[model samples]
Target: MKRRKNIKTVIYHGSIWIIGLLMIYPIFWTIASSLKPENEIFRNSASLIPSIFKWENYAQGWQGFGGLSFSTFFLNSGFVTTMVVIGTLFSSALVAFGFARVKFRFRTPLFVCMIITLMLPSQVTLIPQYILFHNLGWVNTYMPLIVPAFIGGTPFFIFLMIQFIRGIPHELDEAAYMDGCSTFGIFWRVILPLTTPALATVAIFSFYWTWDDFMTPLIYLNDTKLYTVALGLQMFSDPSSVSAWGPMFAMSVASILPQLLIFMFFQKYLVEGITAGGVKG
Candidate 1:
């Protein structure tokens, strides 16, 4: 029996390592490819390591393909993504607090409706939303991409936070009230402090989502000056000729570095937040 148990544990551990490698291989390949020379990119017998590293690809990609600079795109992406993360975190936390703590008429129904929004595909609403923004004179601006975030654009984040908030014991609120705390005071002093882990999770998720968002920025930003990294990557393509593989790979590598750093820095909080939320309500 002990031998069978040991065999099962070994098999499980081996399977997990294989899955981890499968997931990590693409990111490893992208970084490795970014360093390869253009001539070696598609070579039939090329190894993972480049014979000569092409660090100049990053510089070239930063300059621009032909007309526009990627530095401007990076700035635009950073600004928009930062705004989206801030908006999503603040708005979702506030809305989730209301659902989790406050008693009100039709609260359950409203929460259900909010969750229903998550089920609708963005493609279905794309045309109407575009026309609305066009009529509002926001079609070619960052407003369209960043404004909805302030109004609880993501229902899933709100729901995740609500679940986490619900897991906190009601006794804490009652104790705060006994100490002469108002509802707002209890929320500010008690609930928010205890929810740091969940908020970190939401912030990280929002940052990544907005940073990688391509479709919305493509539709809303018209001027070359206003392009995000995702949109700017398209500049590497030459409709009349071959694309620049080295620069494109370099840009892709650079674009993901911020998100990777953020995850690494806040990884502990993210795990605690997720696990704490999983506690029975």
Candidate 2:
């Protein structure tokens, strides 16, 4: 019996390791390809080992093109991502508080509308949003990327916060209110502090989404100098000419560092937030 149990454990762990490797192989390939000479990239694509370690790919990629270094792209992404995360946290928390705590007319209908928006595909609204931004003189600028977040543009984040807030005891709010704390005070002083896990989850998600967003930046940013890392990576590829695969892969690896680091550090909070929100109070 013990031998059978050990065999089962071995099979289970072996399957898990194999699947993990299969999933992570692409990332490993990208890192390996980045270190290989351009000629060897596609030639030996299947192999994780490179014949020559061309560390120069990082240097070349960082040099960028059009007189703007990759630093500019990084700075642009950093700024947009920072603003979006801040805006999302602030707006989602405030809006979630209202829906979860406050009693108001038409609140249920409004909440239903917000949930409906969550189900709506973003592609459906893309054209209309573009036209509206263009009409508002937001084209070719970061405004289109950053402003909507301040207004609770991502309904999913609001919904997540609302669920998390609902899990909190109402007695806390009542206690605060009995002490003469206004609604806003109860939210700011009492509720916000307790929702740290959910907030971290939201911040991490917002950062990841905003940083990795390519379509929005591609559509709005025409100027090379104003490009984010996603757009900057595109600049490496020109169909009419030979593409810089090595440098592109190198920068692709670089682009994901922030996300990897954030996940590594705050992954606990992310899991906690997700689980807590999933359970009703």
Candidate 3:
């Protein structure tokens, strides 16, 4: 029996390792290709080892085009991502608190409407949103990309926060109210502090989404100097000409570092937040 159990454990772990490697193969390939000479990139794409490690790919990629370095794109991405994350957390938390705690007229209907938006595909609203932004003279600017986040653009984040907030005990709110805390005070002093794990989860997700967003940036940003890393990476490809595969792969690897670090640091909080949100008090 023990031998059978040990065999099962080995099989389970072996399967998991195989799956993990398969999932990460692309990333390994990208990294390996980044260091390889351009001629060898596609020629020996299946191999993890490179014949010649061309360290200059990083430098070439960083040099960028039209007098703008890749640093500009990184900075632009950093700024936009930072603002979006802040806006998402602030707006989602405030809106979630209202729906989760404060009782007001039409509140249920409004919550229902908000929930309905979650089911609507973003592409359905894309054209209308673009026209609206265009009319508002927000076309070709970061406004279109960044403003919606501050206005609670992501219904999913609000929904996540609402679920997490609902799991908190009402007695805590009552205790805070007894201490002369107003509604906002209860949220600020009590609810917010206790929702740390959820907030971390939200922040990490917000960072990831905003950083990786390509379509929105592609639609709004036309100036090369104002491009984000996503757009910057796109510049490396030319359908009519030879593409800079090595530099593109190098930049791609660099682009993933921030997300990898974020997940590594906040993975615990992310798991706790997700599990906690599903449970009720």
Candidate 4:
């Protein structure tokens, strides 16, 4: 029995390592390729180590085309992503709090409508959204990307927060009310503090989605100077030919750092948040 159990444990650990490596292989390949000379990249694609490391990829990629460097693109992405995180946190928390706590007329109906919207695909409303933004003269600007978030935030975040808040006891609300706490005060002082894990989850998700968003930025932004990292990565490649693989790979590696760092820093919070938001709430 002991031998069989030991064998099973070994198999489980080995399988986990294998799966982890398989998942990380693409990222490893990108970083390895970034260091290789352009000609050597395809030749040694299967290998994780480059025969000759060309350090110019980072320099070339950051130098960028035209007068604007990658600094501008990074700045633009940072700004948009920051605004999106803030907006998603505030708006989603407020909306979620209302659904979770407050009694309102037709609240269930409104929540159902929000759920329906969640099922609706972005592709379905793409054309209408574009037309509306164009009419509003929000084209070639960050307004289209950032403003919608402040208005409502994502349904997923709202729902997650709602579930999280529901897990909080209603007695707290009653107690706060007894202390002459208003609805807003209860939310701000009590509910908000208790929902930290859920909020962290929302912020992390919002950061990733906003940072990796490509199609929306591509559609709205025509100016090269206003491009985000996603758009900037695409800029390294041209359709006509003569694409810079080395530089593209370099930028791709750089683009991953922010997400990797966020996960590393918030690893505990993320796990707690997801677990907390998943089961009870």
Candidate 5:
């Protein structure tokens, strides 16, 4: 029995290491490729380690194609993502509280409808939404990207929060009521405090989604000044002109750093949040 257990453990550990390597290989390749010169990028006989390191790619990428600097793109992405995360978290949390705690005649049906929205692909509504934004003269602005989030635009976040909130005991609400707490008071004081883990999960997910969103930004933002990292990366590519592989790779690396830092900092809360939600019910 002891030998069998040891063998199983070793197999499991080996499997985990293999999976980790599989996941990390792409990132390693990207970093390695970023160090390689343009001439060596697609070389048939090129080594994994570049014969020479070109650190200047990062600087060139920052400066961007022609006069456009990546600093502007970074600022745009940061501002839009920050607003979207904040808006989504606050809106989704408030709506989830209503769905979880408040009673209404059409509550279940309304939630069902919201879930149905999740089933509908964004592509189906993209043209209509674009037209609406254009009619409102929001085509060239960040408003189209950031404003919808405030209006409970993320049904998935609401659903996730609702599930988490549902797992909280009704006894807690009753206890708070006995202490003279109103509905809003209970939510703000009791529920919100207890739901921090779930909230953190929502916030992190929202941040990552909004930060990486490319299509919406591309469609809405026309001015060069309003470009995000996603669109700015495209400036590195041209069909008529040769693309700069080195600078583009450096820029890509730079774009990923902030998200990496955020995940590293908040990853602990994600596990805690999921575990708490699981056990609470």
Candidate 6:
């Protein structure tokens, strides 16, 4: 029995480490490529270690086209991401609170429709959304990327919040009501605080989704000045001819740092939120 248990333990840990390294290898490769000179990249593509580390790739990439610094792109991405995180958290929490706590006619039907919308691919609504934004004069502006967030946010975030809210006992809500809290007051003071872990999860998801979004910004933004980090990365490439391989890898490595740092800092909350939500459901 002891021999069998030891064999199983060794196999389990061995498989886990193998999978872990496999997942992390791409990130390690990108960083390694960023350090290699353009010429050395393909010359030593098979090797993980670089013969000559070109630190200048970062500097060259930062000196962006049309006199605009890469700092401009990072800043633009930051602003839009911040707006999205704020809007998604605020709006989704409110809507989820209503769905979880409030009772009203047609509430089930409305919630069902909202949940059904999640099953539809975003491409299905792209044309209609584009037309609406165009009519509203939101095209060629960040409004197209930022405004929908405040109105409703994503269905996934809303659903997560709803599930989280349901996990909290109804007695706390009743106690708040006895203490003269209104519906909004109960949500603000009672449910929101208890759902801290879940909210953190939502914020992390929102930040990543908004930061890494390339297509929406591409469709809505026209000027080079308003371009984001994702767009900035693309600026290095010209499919018709030569592309800046070294600099693209350097910036790609840099772009990853922010998200890695955010996730590292919030990892505890993220794990707690996901595990708790899973258990509750």
Error of 2 at 30 (Å): 0.2
| Pairs of residues at least 3 apart in sequence or in different chains that clash in candidate 6 | none
TM-score, per-candidate, Cα-based: 0.87, 0.94, 0.93, 0.93, 0.88, 0.92
Compared with the true structure, all predictions reach lDDT values of 0.84, 0.90, 0.88, 0.88, 0.84, 0.86
Clashing pairs in 4: none
Residue 276: error of model 2 in Å? 5.6
> How would you encode candidate 6's per-residue C-alpha lDDT over 242-272 as one tens digit per residue?
3667877888888878999999899887776
When 2 and 5 are scored with lDDT, the better candidate is: 2
Q: Clashes per prediction?
A: 0, 0, 0, 0, 0, 0
User: How do the residues 192-264 of candidate 3 rate in per-residue lDDT, one tens digit apiece?
Assistant: 9988878888888888889999899998899888999988877755444335778878888888889888888
The root-mean-square deviation over C-alpha atoms between each candidate and the true structure, in angstroms, is 2.9, 1.8, 2.0, 1.9, 2.9, 2.2
Which 10-residue window of candidate 3 scores lowest in summed lDDT? 235-244
- How many angstroms is residue 131 displaced in model 4 relative to the true structure, after the best TM-score fit? 1.1
Residues 39-107 of candidate 4 have per-residue lDDT tens digits of 888985778898878889999888777777888889999999999999999999999999989999999
**Where is model 3 more than 4 Å wrong at Cα?**
241-243, 272-281
| TM accuracy, model 2 | 0.94
Q: Give the runs in model 4 whose Cα sits over 4 Å from its true position.
A: 239-243, 271-281
Q: Write the per-residue lDDT of candidate 1 for residues 1-281, one digit (tens) a residue.
A: 99999999999999999999889978877887788888888883235788888899888777775567888888999999889988988898889989999999999999889878978899998999999999999978999999999999888788888988998999999999999999889888999999887888988888888988888988888887888988887655545533667877788888889889988898886676556545532
